[model samples]
Target: MKRIVFFGDSLTAGYGLHKPEEQSFPALIQRELDAAGLDYRAVNAGVSGDTSASGLSRLSYWLSGPVDVFVLALGANDLIRGLAPSGTQRNLQAIIDQVKARFPLVKFLLLGMQLPLWVPGQRAAEFRQLYRDLAAENEMPLLPFLLDGVAGIKHLNMHDGVHPLAEGYQIIARRVWPVLQPLL
Candidate 1:
């Protein structure tokens, strides 16, 4: 069976969710794939608190098996930690390059994250533009904002206001479905 891997940090890991495997956006995507009878398995390779550099470090392990599609969704932690956007972009690009080196035909989808408004405007803009640049350069799909409808909504987020609740993940799943469907 073909495999699609969602590689990222806490958001992709379904942090704060009681039943992550069943409620994470990747898991929901798996359910969609099953219902559509697609011959693919969705692998959730999300690690909480992972930065782009950390994700890049683990890319080799995830690339060990056949990967038909790779959903890149890291960098949030880097943003939170005030890491340079350039560094995040470079690490993300390196991860993609490594994956391509191993699986020349693997497809990619970049799930971009936005820094909260509190961050400096210039840095935030740079961080936001990185994903667009990467997606264009790589000729792959890009989801501009992973938390489009769920972010800042009191009801959708957990108490800490960083992670999404189960209901929020459902919304995220729906938003990601269209982008992922074409890939599948």
Candidate 2:
């Protein structure tokens, strides 16, 4: 089967989920693919607390295998650590570049994150715009906010309020499915 690599941080990793192997977004998508009889596999390449730079550092491992689709969901950790948006953008672009070079036919989907408006700062605005810029420049699909319905929703998230619970992931899966289905 073809591969769809979901690369990102804890959100993509399904952090705090008791059964991440079966509850992560990637795993949920896998179930969808199977139910639809789609000839593809979902590969969850998410790592907890990974910044864009860190994710780039380990890109090769994921690229070692055949990749048909690449879903990027990084940058949250970078924002949390107050890293520069430019640096995060550069690292994310590098990841995209390397993946494209490795698999010319690989489709891409960029998952974006946005800080709440109450979190005041120009940096916050820049962080949100980076995804749009990257998506436009790369001519790829972009999910404006990965945690759209789940973010700030106490019940949908774990105590940490960052990672989503299984139910939250289900909503995420729903949001991503329409965008991802066309690519598949």
Q: How high is the CA lDDT of each candidate model? A: 0.93, 0.95
Tell me the lDDT of candidate 1. 0.93
Over 4 Å off, model 2: none
For candidate 2, write residues 1-184 as lDDT tens digits: 8999999999988889999999999999999999999999899999999999999999999999999999999999999999999999999999999999999999999999998878778998899899999999999999999999999999998998888999999999999999999999
lDDT (tens digit, per residue) of candidate 1 on 1-184: 9999999999999987899999999999999999999999999999999999989988889988999999999988998899999999999999999989999999999999987657678889899889999999999999999999999999999999889999999999999999989987
For every model shown, the clashing-pair count is: 0, 0
Clashes of 1: 0
Q: Model 1, residue 57: what's the lDDT?
A: 81
Global fold similarity of model 1 (TM-score): 0.97
Q: Which 10 residues in a row give candidate 2 its minimum summed lDDT?
A: 113-122
**C-alpha lDDT (0 to 100) for residue 55 of candidate 2:** 100
Q: Give the RMSD in angstroms, all C-alphas superposed, for model 1.
A: 1.1
Which residue pairs clash in candidate 2? none
